[model samples]
Target: MDPRLLELLVCPVTRHPLSYDKAAQELVSPKARLAYPIRDGLPIMLESEARPLDAED
Candidate 1:
């Protein structure tokens, strides 16, 4: 994802800044522990589409 776009993207639920998880290919909301998928090079920012983070992670 582009840095410019990442700067503008926020958590769809928490409205907090999201961190780019390159290895996971997802945009992670640290505060929310939600990982939104990046599909076909586009981010799917919807809450329903995001996956919950595992406790151990």
Candidate 2:
């Protein structure tokens, strides 16, 4: 994903800033405890498409 795009992206749930996990290809919303998937370089920002964080996460 483009760095400029990432900087503009935010968590749909919490409306907070997200951190990019390059290795995981995910946009992590710490406040929302959700991980939005980035597939084919496109972010799936929908809350319905998000994966809940595990206890260890």
Candidate 3:
């Protein structure tokens, strides 16, 4: 993803800043404990589409 876009994107639920997880190909919202998927080079920011983070995460 573009750095400009990444800088502008935030967690939809918590409104917290997102950090890109290159290995997982996700935009992680640590505060929200959610990882939004990046599909086909586009971010799926919907909460319903996010994966919940476990304790290990």
Candidate 4:
């Protein structure tokens, strides 16, 4: 992911800032407890496509 783009992107559900997880290729929203996937270098920011976080996450 581009550093500039990551800085601009926010969680659609909580409108909170997202953190990049390079290994997982996800943009994680701690406030929303969701992980938005990055596919083919593009972020899929939709709420429906996000994965819910577990206690460990």
lDDT of candidate 3 vs native? 0.96
Best model per lDDT? 3
Clashing pairs in 1: none
Per-residue lDDT of model 1, residues 1-57, tens digit only: 999999999998999999999998999998999999999999999999999999975
lDDT of 2 by residue, 1-57 (tens): 888998899898888999998999999998999999999989999999999999888
- Candidate 3's TM-score reads 0.96
Clash count, predicted structure 4: 0
Q: Rate the local accuracy (lDDT) of all candidates.
A: 0.94, 0.93, 0.96, 0.95
Candidate numbers sorted by lDDT from highest down: 3, 4, 1, 2
**Decoy 2 TM-score against native:** 0.93
TM-score of every candidate: 0.93, 0.93, 0.96, 0.96
TM-score of 4: 0.96
As for TM-score, the candidate ahead, 2 or 3, is 3
Clashing pairs in 2: none
